[model samples]
Target: MPELLTTSGNIALTPATFQHRLLEWYDRHGRKTLPWQQDKAPYRVWVSEIMLQQTQVATVIDYYRRFMARFPDVHALAAASQDEVLHLWTGLGYYARGRNLHKAAQILVERYGGEFPVHSLEAMTALPGIGRSTAGAIIAISTGQRGVILDGNVKRVLARLHAVAGWPGKPAVERELWRLAERYTPDERLDDYSQAIMDLGATLCKRGTPSCLFCPFEDVCLAHAQGEERRFPESKPRKVLPERQTIMLLLRNEEGRLLLEQRPGAGIWGGLWCFPQFDDREALSRWIDAKAPGAILEPAWNSFAHTFSHFRLHIVPQPARCKRTGHVSEVDTLWYDSARPANIGLAAPVKQLLNASRPFAAQPSF
Candidate 1:
């Protein structure tokens, strides 16, 4: 009988003690009616799990609804084009999730006859982006199978509950956390227990300022008892994000068509349409002068900054008018009506800029 031990003291976690305490709180206060919880179908659980990665539930609600309405099932999703799938997942950061979902759907249809495999962690992990945690979640939640899950929310919860110190990113810390998770997971009610733990972490044991007053485990929580609830999961040293500067060319042709190019299918904002960009203003000016000589250059429209987890991008938008009669296929360039940008795959930031300028572009003022 494995027991729950904390840095402060060792506490026996019998079935009755754990269930009576946690389940009582869950029954009264846990989140119950989330859209994904409505169906325990493997597909539904898989989609929601993937969408919930590094994204908030509030942000994923509309996207999830729209995505389900569009794809509806594994077959539908597998049959859809990558471009369409990526377009649907446009605003969702971490584009890799969308791409992986598409790939996984295809794998399910072709390899497993459009049904998720049962208790096949290896098969699930073989898919593009279905990691160990995600595969475990699908198996545990949908099939009621016992498996280890180590998502960020779960990590935070377990780290604090056990007072596991050191950066959770390190291999040693992660192994200890996994051991604790494996030990505490109940045999029966596996799915419900998984959801309960995740809910506890998401709702009560949040990263910053946890709601200790309402937490069921507050009585036994070592961190809470020690009056250092926030200090359980020791913080890691931070590194400064590097800054990058770039110039974006907002070029238009004679017939109100914008010139854009599709980015390569790797790196930042891959496979999305954007204005021709250069790392430096001098390089941009040289390219424009050489390619489209005597083109009229207007004042800069907007200067904005977009930050990623690791880097910050400072972008300057320079509007220009050019007339050229050479082949554009060599440069991956295309001209499209700015009003209908969805026809082409424009990145979210580019789409925002285009939509903001639509009203002005519509009105004819000399």
Candidate 2:
């Protein structure tokens, strides 16, 4: 088929020509310097895809480097404990990704002998935290399979390119997008094409203030033509996020270790270390009396709000200087010496709170 082009030299994206144009543009101007791009191993692709979910590339870059440095491969990740895994993933929010990555690594080690099951997309998706799009990305980027992906960036890129209507989360709209993705994915240069579309989405077709003039598909993008790029990828239905309150303690011993407890592996901040939390001051005092017999309580700090995806947490931090050395040691609780830093994984808010409270230390303020 003859290629269609605009006077500005950009090609009109059709199923046959979209890959060529995108890849041509990607060759000249795509972000190939990403840490994961240097090595197209399935493990690296899978890890990068998971970290990129709901997170910007710039933010994930440092986290990805640190995580890869710690857990170099599946064998290294599988042999490590969950605490160790979560610790490396501390500041990276959506912690379930960390847990699920650990869980999936164990499964891979046990079932596939410490390697990603790159032979099939279905096998990859069968593991924890590996969705269809992620699985496709892992396979397509690593093995040059004609696998299709529809992550947030690709979703926006495709939605605008095709002018897809309705929310991408909707069943019907998603099915259509999936069909389009499958149709457009090229048989040749599959890896470059996959990365090209993703790079295009992340760079040009952004959520706010898209650089339409620079996009390769500028002449062909339906949404761009209609001046409704944002409208194509419809927003999710909005609902009110709930708010809750709690008292978070930052107890310190004479040795200058902060009291940190491992959270249960199910709810918010699951399997992560945080200070003891209470619904009210009364409950907090009762626990303190029972746990630290001669601990002296410092003046409480004002309640501050931390927003989660579903709720807002109003945290009242109550720091204490404990003189007692006879406190019972709980299995999952510890006096964490922040000086060591790498022994445990802390929740983001806890880390922030502790960092902000350094001046007080274990000594009480008047």
- Candidate closest to the true structure, highest lDDT: 2
For model 2, residues 1-366, the per-residue Cα lDDT tens digits are 333343222334567788788888999999898999999888888899999999989999998999899989988988999989888888888889999999999999899988788777789889999999998898889999778898888889888887889998899999999988998898888889899999888887888889998887877887887788879799998889898999998898888888888899988999999999999889988998899877888888877788888889988888888986559378888877766665577888898877776655652421
| Model 1, residue pairs in steric clash | none
**Each prediction's TM-score against the native?**
0.91, 0.92
Error in Å for residue 290 of model 2: 2.3
* Local distance difference test, candidate 2: 0.85
Report, for every candidate in turn, its global Cα lDDT versus the true structure: 0.79, 0.85
Q: After superposition, how far is residue 59 of candidate 1 from its true place, in Å?
A: 0.7
- Which pairs in model 2 have colliding backbones? none
**Tens digit per residue, CA lDDT, model 1, 1-366:** 233354445365454566567767777888878888898899999999999999998999888998899989999999988778888888887887887899889988998899887578898888887888888888888988886688888888878777788888888999998887777777766677778888888888998999998877776777776778788677776899899988888777776676778888777877777888998878987887777676688987657887888998887877778776353335567876756655445677677666655546542321
Following a full C-alpha superposition, what root-mean-square deviation does model 1 have from the true structure?
3.5
TM-score of candidate 2 versus the correct structure, residues matched by position: 0.92
